[model samples]
Target: MSEPPPEPTSIGTWAKRYYYANRAAVEAVLRPHGLGSTQWAVLYELTTSGPTSQRDLGRVLHIERASLSGVVATLVRKGLVEQTPSETDQRQRLVMLTDAGRSVWKKLPDPFAEVRTVALEGVDAGEVATAIRVLERATAQVERHSFG
Candidate 1:
C-alpha cells in the first residue's frame, strides 16, 4: 500500500512567525508616533467602528479581558483614547478615540499600505483568499469545539 503524505505544517506555527515579523515592522514605524501595535489596532477600530464597549472590543480582537485592560489603560493615559460608561449599560466601559487617535489613524494608511503591499507583493490573490478562508474556518471550528 502507498504511504500517506506527510503531515503538513500547522498554521499556528506560521501565524506566530507572521505576528512576530509584523510586530517588528509595526514597532519600527509606530515608535516615532508613540504607539504600540495593540494601541494602533485599538485606535483604528474605534476610529472605524465608533465607540465600543471594552468587553466587546476585546472580543472582536480575540484578546483576553485582562490583557486589554492594560492596553486600554495605556491608551487612556496617553490621551489617545477615553473611556466612559456605556449609555445603555452603566457597568460596561466604552472606549472612544480622541482627536489624537484619529490623527494617528489618518496618518497611518499610507505607511500601513506600504507594509501591506510588501506583504502581499508576489502573493497570488487566489492563494490569499484560500488562506483566509482556511484560517477563518479553523478558528470557527476551534471556538465551536472549545466553547460550545
Candidate 2:
C-alpha cells in the first residue's frame, strides 16, 4: 500500500497555503465582475482614501511598484481609474477612481467579507482572535527579519 502523504508541519507552509486559498476565494468572487484581488484592493484603497500617489498606494497595499504599475495601467484601460501627475511632484502619479469605478465599486459586494464568512463558518470567535494574533506576530517577525 502507498504511504500517506506527509502533512504540512511548518507554520510558514500553512501560512502560504492559507494566503493562496484566500486569494483564490477572493478571485472567484471577483472574477464575474472582471476584477482580480489586487485590482479590487487598488479600487478599495482609492475609494476610501481618495486620490493618492502611486508610491503611497503601493506601500499601503504592500504591492511592489512594478506590479502596481501594471495593475494601474489595466484599471486605466478599463476606464475605472485615472492617473495624473502630481501638482507638487511631477514625477509622482496620483491615482484615483473614476466615476465609473465608483459606480462599479458601489455595486460589487465585499469579496473578503463574503469569503471570510464562509471560511470561518463554524469557528469560535475566541479561536479566530487567537489565530489572528498568532499570525500577526509571525508576520511581523518574518517581515522584520526579511527587511533587516
The prediction achieving the highest TM-score against the true structure is 2
lDDT value, candidate 2, whole model: 0.94
Report the C-alpha lDDT of model 1 over 11-122, residue by residue, as the tens digit: 8878677778876876777888787777778887898799999999999988899999999999989888999999999999999988977776787743466567788899
| Model 2 Cα lDDT, one tens digit per residue, 10-117 | 766787888899999999999999999999999999999999999999999999999999999999999999999999999999999999999999999899999999
Query: What CA root-mean-square deviation does each model show from the true structure?
Result: 5.2, 3.9
Runs in model 2 deviating more than 4 A are 1-7, 145-148
Which pairs of residues clash in candidate 1, taking residues 3 or more apart in a chain or in different chains? Answer: none
Per-model C-alpha lDDT, please? 0.84, 0.94
